[model samples]
Target: MAGASSRGGGDVAAAALRRCTATAIHSGADPAWSSRLTRPRERDGMVVVYGDARRRLERRATDGAPAVLRRSTAEEEEETRKKVTGGNGEKGEREWRVNVPVVGGHAGITIVPLFSQAVPKANLADEDIKAPTKRTQDGGTKVVQAKAGKGSATLSMAYAGALFADACLKDLNGVPDVVECSFVQSSITELPFFASKVKLGKNGVEEVLELGPMSDFEKQGLESLILELKSSIEKGIKFGNQ
Candidate 1:
């Protein structure tokens, strides 16, 4: 369930949690909100899974593994250097038609999708590849605009939550090869907690997978996102502990 407000939501969720004995799975937009909500539960010795929806969508796209990498084409490289364009020099279509490996936190600029490292090797031009990356980053805003601001991303958030929950159930049932990305206490990066592809098991996180091969574009994204991601993570840790 979504947390109402950072403080109120945390208090409510924490109180409600004391009444149950279930593994906690948090699905919300704000990492700080989720951090505030899940921290007390974790402190109480409950298993907690915390990842906002956008990052979970990325996990679903990648099929829960760090995809095999391939070298980017020259055209792709050129497009990465500038704004993507079509052959006629007009705006292109919006489509993320490949399994792009996404990492980092679920927020603007921090949501890093590795389009160049997409599996099955998308033959799309670099300009086209950027389409999905931008869309993925702005997906929530797009929904809000389409709704004319009457509502937020209610349905999509529900779907993302169900998807993660399903993966958890499969792993708990001993279903072989159940992998999903989640934000947990991770050593994958320098951050105390990070979102990355993780293998799920009966005991919870079986293994946190390594980020596989990436292109120069993806490498740059990784470096750029880390700073912001670190700040956001530190903010959450501080707020949660408070």
Candidate 2:
């Protein structure tokens, strides 16, 4: 499935979906952030998963979708981590998996990564976790800086968009247990729309998984983020209604 990042495309796309009864899976940063309106009546058919490609890579590692199949061993994960960040020869020095269960909205503070729950397990100090959390929050800015303010994170976002779209299509075509993190109208949190791991099927979002267990740091992060995420969702809803 092709993806576009044009403004108001969600409006046009949703209008088309209403007419043709077609489903949509979106990963545009703006559209996914504002999915309540982008896919108003889609029910389970509208899937929104947008943000860092790193996050998607992490999810794919654990979900056993393709490429690497079984979960990455600590050593392998460390190597992969070094490759992504250009870390200075830290492969054998440390071992950790990229198991970030990102949630909430797709913006700073709103984007909550559950490093505490990461598998193969991350034996990181609070400072280490804090650094990645902030990095995830400001990932877009780093891209924008690298581009010299010419364009946003088009390439990475597109890759992430296609990845999510492929997963949705696979689920629609009867692939079982197709799960991914997405922002959707949910009761999992107090907010009307939140991003979390969702099970996909022919019908769409078959299930919205809970946030499960979190470390004290993660819990604090979640609490601090809720207000901002709620405001973002409210803003999207207000704009959509207009």
Best by TM-score: 2
Residue-by-residue lDDT tens digits, candidate 2, 1-242: 22223344555433333322222333334433323332334411222223232234334333322332211111011111111121111433232234456777665677777766655356665666776777767766566667664555555565555556667668757899997777788998788987778898877788999899887777788889888777666755654454
After superposing candidate 2, which stretches have Cα over 4 Å from the reference? 1-97
Against the true structure, candidate 2 reaches a TM-score of 0.65
Candidate 1, residues 18-88: lDDT per residue as tens digits? 33322333333432332233243442221123223323333332332334111101101111112122211
Model-by-model lDDT, in order? 0.50, 0.53
